[model samples]
Target chain A: MFNPPTELLPTATNQSGTRTAAVPSVGGRTGIARILLSRDTVMIYALVAFVIYAALFIPRFASPVSTGFLLLDVIPALLIALPMTLVIITGEIDLSVASIAGLTSALMGVLWGAGLDIGPVLIISLIAGVLAGAFNGLLVAVLGLPSLAVTIGTLALFRGLALVVIGDNAVANFPPALTSFFTSKIGGTGIPTVMIGVILVAIIFGVVLHLTPFGRGLFALGYSKEAAIFVGIKVVRAKFWLYVASGSVSALAGIYWTLRYSSARSDNASGLELTVIAAVLLGGVSIFGGKGAIPGAIAGVLLIGTINFTLRLGRISDVVLIIVTGTLLIASVVAPSIFEGVTKWLHARRHRRTLPQASASGATRATASGVQERK
Target chain B: MTLDTSPPATSETTTRRANGFAAVLRLREIPVTLALIALVTLTYMANPLFLSQQGVKDLLLNATIVIILSVGQAMVIVTRNVDLSIGSILGIVAFSTGTLFVTFPGIPIVLVFLAGMALGALLGSINGCLVTVAKVPSLVITLGTLYIYRGLNNAWAGGTQYFAGDRPDSFGALSVDTIAGFPVITLIAIVVVIIVAIFMASTRPGRDLYAIGSDPEAAKLFGIPVTRRVLLAFLSNGVLAGLAGVLYASRFNSVGATTGTGLEFDIIAAAVVGGVAIFGGSGTVIGAAIGALLLTTITSALTAIRVDKFWQQAIVGLLILAAIVIDRIARIRTAKKLRLSEARDV
Candidate 1:
């Protein structure tokens, strides 16, 4: 009784062969289609396409020298984006990352200027970042304050503290060995030596996000906090640790930024947060959370870095670069929703057309059943 | 009948509930107001010159643009949206105002103001369309426009900056001219705050914005035109930002590509500190105006007290954190009270 006869199923399908064919294979083939058309895949494709385009058309952009410069420029953003991808996936933001980096740089400068050993200065700067992140975690995760508001406050506070620490002084007397080491490339390859460290960070973040139970819990937490709690996910603890990670990673980026430039100033990596966020979002991470991958995010960072490098190599003004990044950020978000809306509308239209036939058959079946009951 | 006895109980609860709501409304603006007064008094005590006529004038002038911007921002925030592009809007418009004077030396000041506002409205509509039509979050869209508009300004104004000397004397006098010991520009900001406060408090569309912010899905289900109201909020915000830009041109030393860069954070901080919920649904233009006053005064106060001026930004940051934490605590207490009252009713 539960399974309809094969003959009856054909009657239902007789209204439209095309509809039958379209509807029956949704379970298997559509899954493959969806995977292929996913935002991450699209981002990877775009990244590859743009690189090829740049290498082909842009003069001097294909060279190893440009590759090294570009990689060096994007290292800070790339490093920060790793932990940022996790934070965003859990549906929070850390606008203070750049400020934390700035503060770290300022502290390093001050400590180094005070004749402290470089080793201790670096450790203290990183510790300061951890403390800053802990402060944010206390407010946001423990106290339940909104992350957006909390981070904006910290953004200002950290940057302000940076100003007080350095007082507009730029510390440039870093040991020459370390500065050159930051810019040094792998032998025979144009990629910065720092890329190795960046890639390692990326791989660690990827494994944590894609493989671990804690990461799976974050996806659930992003979708519904109450449900996550019901499932025993330690929401507060998870978020606190994410904030800590973001802070520590930002500090690492700050260190890299300072050494690469051989300068530590209050404004070091000041606006880097926006660029990192833009890249992450462009990588197909849902701004609302619960979606994104490390590889996609890496592709996003490289894509923007390559575009900017190409533009600079072409002698285009920075204005165009800014505009392009903004446009791409908006387009990346808007395009997906628009596509979804269109698909939904199309599906609705198809359902509406098929509804009359469905109801007619339903009415006939109801009459037959009524006759049988009466008999 | 039970009805006879229930009437008195119901009436008593009704009056109590009404009082509770009124108290909450008063409480929202009280903390920011108290902070402002305390800061001013303490600063004045530290250095009498802090409240001298020139000092007072400087404070008012300093807050004028921020006050205007925050008042506008309150409208958008009230509807669960934000406009980060206002800084960029102000920058582009201020530069245009400068360019107008540079190109047409005798252009009427009123026309420039109108032009700036119109441009702001146009830019704002783009944000509104992207948000309302595209169904994207306002935060992301505005962030995009922030960069895009700033880039446009940079490309247009490339190394050319219009200074105070570039504008006509009368144009600059708008900021200089005073009435009743208040600079004309400051008066304009006051009028803007008052007008916006009234509109938000007593109008249907304004109240609808609050409803939308409180629960967007419910607001839509209730037949409120959420899209149109949100669009209107953005439109009005744009107009106010434009007005601030024209005033910014009159008051500041120079107008260029980066004229208003980084001002968005300050405007947002003022609104948040003023009691405007960053998440939306509650906050008043008046409170935000006071917040603007408080923040700008802190800068002057720190300088006057010979405290490191660097502390000003840190103080502003601390105030924002304090404001939001207070807001959270208040919300929790209110919810608890409401639940207890409901249990009693049952």
Candidate 2:
């Protein structure tokens, strides 16, 4: 009875926003529905448009070789985003993913430097990542600390531990075969072998998020924790394991990053969280949670990658790149609501023009500010 | 999780007693002060020079900028917002201050500071305007600004760095000049802290800030000027960060694009460690200042004892976690106690 209602609940009764009718079951969207009028259709079309534009304008940009390199550049962020989408979908964020990747990379370096074999090093690093995620989960899901506060601390803690394990030193002497395999292209193709890992992970994440009961449960949980609880969803356990999954994926990404770069450094992938979050949010994943798809996030990732590539080709300064990213991130957040508002205004205008008397005008206009006023 | 900031039942003797003790524990910086003393004592036992006059000055000098920034940062956080762009602001102001000295060799010392503060307030106002108008979470807005400002700093620097020799020695001496063995800059930080502390403690707007943080909807219903206050908080934080930037130029004797890169996290760590609740509605500038001192001292002590520098960051991280966990535990106990009291009344 003392429990405050704002947290982990269906917010339908409590806030000023359009409430989505809860998806009733594990029935994933069919192709036609998925492609048409979905929230992320904008991102999907933009990605396609960007690809088309780049193909026509930029030299060799449409080639498979450029795609391979682009994927490699974005691989670390893309890998982390797979799980991040789930976490964000569940109404939580994992800011420590980059730090976990760094820590895993550091662990690999320190262990390898001590002459440990690569196999054990990889295993241990992945385990450490899972443990880190578990710790965050325990705090947030069980102890019920705010994830924002908890993850901010853990971000530092994980990064600090990475520094402690390998202080300011870069280990670049990973076994040549591993580095070669990590960076190597497929036979006579522009595709990198790393695509295998990414594709495999993406397929798994896609199926799990869209086609499975657990995936439906994630959506339910995000839409409303209290509702999910009432529906017998294990809210705490789902949140706990989501973090664990995030951690493990990050660790795998770290191993990939270490091999891909042929170096292990404490600061590897620093500031990566922002880019991944930008991608996720850009993909039409609601920052407010419970509405997103992996395909959209992928498209978002590719759009950012294409933009980065085209800008680089234009010889734009790296500083300009960061500014573009910041701008795009901000625009992605603000533009959607503005679009909704304009459409609503237009609809209202059309309605007013058609009808002489506007009955129920108050009810129609009451939701005008709802999109902007989340609180 | 509810983030409801309704006050406890004051009529119950048990609740009142518990609250009084908790307030005393929280209001006084006793825990942090005691921790600082213990850490220093232990470190001194290992290395006496750490407590030596020069060592003490070094600690104070290192902590001054962080302390000033923490005071400002605490205010922003207390209002359920954060300014991640602070480090960037510091970098910009520091570099700008250095450029001012180079550009106008005859410029008065105070004018440089004023110029830097004006630049900072302008940046802060931009942040304020975007946050208030857009209604985006401060995290997203400031995160965007963090990179934007840093990018601006980088673009401005364009691989150039300003050295101490570029400035008048009088400007450099501002950091070193001692008043009764205390650095002038440190004194300035203390004064800023005291003033902000007083303002937060005694002013209506200041109290309103806590109310807004605790439960913003209620604060709005109560007719608190949420937008203006939040805007002011960001602006004020910007001003302090600018002050810190000016000090950074003096103390570090060099200004570069990377002057304050990644320091926002460190400042946040200091505030969280010092017991400023990240979720808002609690903590003090004094506690935050002491937190800055403690964190800086820990670094100095660890360096003095020849421990790994990485441990310092980890320890700060741990302190952040500890503070949150302690807060969680306290909330749980208070909740249980409140429930028990309700049961007894029934």
Which number leads on DockQ?
Answer: 2
Per-residue lDDT for B1-346 in model 1, tens only?
A: 0112345456856875878977765467888999999999998998999999989999999999999999999999988888989999999999999999999989988899999999999998899888887878888888889889999999999989999999999989988889989999999999999888989977778878897888776676567777888999999999999999999999987999898888888899899999999888998999899999999999999999999987877888899999998888878987998899899999
Give candidate 1 misplaced runs (Cα > 4 Å). A1-34, A354-375, B1-26
Candidate 1 docking quality: incorrect, acceptable, medium or high: acceptable
Give the top-scoring candidate (TM-score): 1
DockQ of each: 0.37, 0.44
Docking class of 2: acceptable
> What is the Cα-based lDDT of residue A222 in candidate 1?
71
Residue pairs with clashing backbones, model 1:
none
RMSD of each: 7.9, 4.6
